[model samples]
Target chain A: MNLFLDALAWIVAPERFEGSSSLFVRLGEHLYFTAFSVLIATVIAVPIGYLIGHTGRGRELAVGLSGAARALPSFGLILLLVLVMGVTNKPAAAFTAFVVLAIPSILAGAYAGFEAIERRTINAARAVGMTEWQILWRVEVPLGLPLLIGGIRSAALQVVATATLAAYIGLGGLGYYIFRGLPLGRYDEMLGASILVAVLAIVIDAALALCQRLFVPRGVAAGRTPSLRTAPARRRAMVETSTAP
Target chain B: MNWVLDNLDLIGRLSLEHLRLSITPILAGLLIAIPLGWLAHRYRLARGALLTSAGLLYTIPSLALFVIIPPILGISYLSELNVTIALTLFVIAIMARSVADALDSVDGNVRQSAVAVGYGALRRFFTVDLPLAGPVILSGLRVAAASTVSLVTVGILIGVESLGYLFTNGYQRRIVEEIFSGVVMVMLVALLIDLALVALGRLAMPWARRPGRAAR
Candidate 1:
């Protein structure tokens, strides 16, 4: 409790907010690493996920690959990359870890989003003369936006949280405080940084959840009258798995 | 290759330690998550709050949770207990949601029939609902196992010994082969656990594996 109070006080102290290594500066650097990695991951993963989801090819392989990718330990990967690549360019090593960590969630999100759409609705769009590309962009992408955003949400939180490991490799981020504080016994600083990280994750997830709710097509959101075979369990499973990182 | 061969004994010991650290927490987590999951599923009022809290807990970074646990629990920062407790918390947070979802996936009519047949609540849960929810719960377990295996590598950063000791030591010595071996070992462990769990899931849920059954 004392540590918590000290952390709260440290967070509000004006002196703590303005220096070169101020909490705000570390926070900025942390967000930079997170946002940059997520951007690159989004660029790489979203397209691959989109292609696979749209064509329905390689779905099994992609799922297996993403699972393997997710299973890679972030800490181990960072250290391995840094060791292999040499410590001269630490950001490259750190970013690679972050990017790898971010990819599986985003990829899962993107493809799962596409898969969540009703096949009948997609066929109806095609029947109306939409080309493959048109159907993809016009029909699938819009409806899948919610899941896409949800995936990004998961990826962003993952990157933000995992980016703390970057400090281990001497890269600047909020993790630096915790790493430095541990050896120095600076509990307030360590706890304060952790609080920031937890709050950042929660705030980001909440925002994305809101985005998911808003982006879901109203017709789909407000389901049709229940038939005898609602398949409610299956539908719930789809939503649950798709949204999970 | 020569270095890896020479270090085989050390690797074997570390691997055993890693397994001990990773597997214990997962088993403990399963025991804790099932009841929590049951509570979340059984009560309408508790469902939202339970799920939300679990979800929130899942969002905490693994490293952060690891560091935070010592202070909260009043354990030594370097204690293996810190890693075990944190990983257990992680497994519970993740598995609880999966468990609740799995229980929800059990057919309503099947549960109704069990009730209709005069089985007591506990008997029905064990004999019917649990077996039916087995596949999904097992899938969640696979994830938890793989994740825990991978995460045990992080224990090295905090001065705890595991496979990650190789990575940290290798980094300090600038020994590329040592780091490579560590990474490879962790991946192998993760893959093995994932495959084993998949096989176990298949064996436990024979009906789910049949053709024309639900495609998991």
Candidate 2:
């Protein structure tokens, strides 16, 4: 259809490559918010999840809380924060909201990674005279690296998808075009922006899938290549199923 | 608190609207996903392609999906149908994979025995595999339901009516109470729906209620 071609042409047009709202700038802003939010989430979530997994306490609580947190509407959260912050500090409000959205997936990943480690393996490490800290870092961390990365992948994907909301509050991202164009009846610009967001998401997901494959312990990665991409999906399923309490 | 009390009727109406906007998609998704999931599960060649496509569809941002859906379907942007169809797409993307995964979780030996007992394919699916896959399916439905409830709020950005309108309206008007109420009401609705689904699952699956199974 003409619409599809127009959108494609709009994307490849030279003007789209320059200026403040250029494709490159918006992509960078999208990545910056995503990376920053995921980093903050990892810093907070990983340690809490690691501790919970190590101690073998409060996992039900953590998983339940994470599930509950996931159910909190991101749009509502962002707008509420904006209102609370007086809209003068839009970036800070948006950053905090995105961080909140990113945390649950990362935390679920961290705890699930530790949960996936074998009890017998940890016991063997202990028998070999490894201290608690040594066991955590030496035995658990390396083995859990793949799932940790999977969690980060999930968090990154979520942040990337949701970060378009940044544009709702006047922040920069690919979402800017879609939101702006919809009101102005510029369907080509809207579709072009959407295509870019989708492409960015798929590229990042595939790249993370590759990272998961590369970083998994050799023994674990040996025969499980096909199922590597499902690591986060399985962990997410576990989180959903384990929330009875 | 006083403001919340004063606007209770408006909040109640929007909450109902939110429920309608979100819950319809889950029902629609379930209707479609059951057959697609079973087909994916039944065939070797279709599994990879089916699951992969579902996964890929899920990666499209919610906002982008909302924006493009009207144009793609040739519908008016302001129609509530846009949100319904988009959310239905999301639910199907999530539920189809989970449905297939749940079917996969059913014990192979159990399925084999049912076939050996002379049960027909369609009969075996309903009487044997489906009941066995119930718990996992319910959990997947729970995830989809919670997600749908949260996503319904995004409909507001496209100027659709829902509890999210409270957030947008309150923010624009600087009415802190309305925004807080919107946030609180959405969470409560999600929690209630989740609990209702769990209760329904338990009621429907009597075998899951057995305390002696934990003896293992």
Candidate 3:
């Protein structure tokens, strides 16, 4: 339609790419906020998640709390923080909000990753005289990876979406055009920016989906767990009966 | 505190409006998605196409959709209908996939039995498959309900009248109590709706209420 065409024109207008507040800058800002917050959230949430998952402790509580946390309206949290912390420091308030938003998904993913590993594998590792730390790194971490990445993917998506809304705090991001253009009635800019952001999200999701596929080891991809038996035992078992992934 | 007290009338009105905006889409989405889900579940070829598009549709942020929807619908950009319509699309996107999965979750043996007993296709679906799929669909519905309730607040940014109005209005005027009330009220509404859904699921599917199952 004419509106979508005009929006496309707005995106390609040469001047829109040159200034400090240009399209590239806004796009960078959006990715910057998304990456920063997701990283921080992973650092904070992953350890606790791993701890909970490995120790077999507090998973029910973690799941419940994370589910409950989703209802804590981020828009209100951002505004409340800005008011309490000082409007002069919008990024700090906004950063805190984004981190909180990113935590629940990453936490769920982290714990679910370790939890997904079968107990038989852990028991085998223990019987083989593996130390606690050794078992964690060699056994649990490797197996827990696919689900961990899955959590991060969803976390990244959530942050990307929320960062657009964070533009209301006067931060620069793809959402700037949508929010800032609203009052000015700049429908073309709004539509153009929204379309760009939507495309960015889809591309990122597809890339992560690829990562999800590629990151899994060939055996796991083939739907078989790696056996812990010694090579000779594995060969003996293979000789006795065919066990194919 | 007095500010909240003085505006209790306003708060009550906004809460009602918020419930209508949020709940309308959820119910409307569930109704529309049942058939779409049935199609996707019944036909293998349609499954990939339906699920893929729904996943992509869900990835677009709610705020962005608020802006993008009006132009496509040829409605006023600030119209509440835009918010409701966009919310409905998101709900449908989420619920459709869940519905398909829910239908797929029904026991194959039970379905075979229904056919063997001479129940017509439509009657079997309505009586047996749908009821058996109820718990899974209800679980998905709970998730959608919570998110939808929270999502309604974002519509405030685009000039939709909901509890989200309290957020913007309170923030601009720097009234912490007003904003705080909005947050609390939104959560309360979400909790009540979720509890109601759980009760409905329990009442409708008494067979699902085993003490040992911890699906939650």
lDDT of 3 by residue, A107-189 (tens): 99889999988899899999999999999888888788888889989888888888888888788899988987889999999
Give the per-residue lDDT of model 3 (tens digit) for B58-149: 89988888878888889987888888888888888998899998887776666777777898989999999899888889888888888899
- Cα error, residue A151 of model 2, in Å, equals 1.7
lDDT of 1 by residue, B117-176 (tens): 898989998999888888889888888888888888877867779999988888888888
Select the stronger candidate by lDDT from 1 and 3. 3
Worst 10 residues of 3 chain B by lDDT: B105-114
| Model 3: fraction of native contacts | 0.48
lDDT of 2 by residue, B1-216 (tens): 888999999999999999888789989998888888887876656778888888888878787787667777888767789989988999999988888878877776677677778889799999998888788888888888888898899888778899999988987888889989998889888888888888887788988777754201
For candidate 1, list the clashing residue pairs, or say none: none
Native contacts, share recovered per candidate? 0.41, 0.55, 0.48
Q: What tens-digit string does per-residue lDDT give for candidate 1 at A17-57?
A: 78788887888899899889999999999999999899899
What are the TM values for chain B, all candidates? 0.93, 0.94, 0.96
Q: State the displacement of the C-alpha of residue A118, model 3, in Å, after optimal TM-score superposition.
A: 2.9
TM-scores of chain A across candidates? 0.87, 0.89, 0.88
Instruction: State the C-alpha lDDT per candidate.
Output: 0.82, 0.84, 0.86
Superior by DockQ: candidate 1 or candidate 2: 2
Candidate 3 TM-score over all chains jointly: 0.92
Question: What's the candidate order when arranged by decreasing lDDT?
Answer: 3, 2, 1
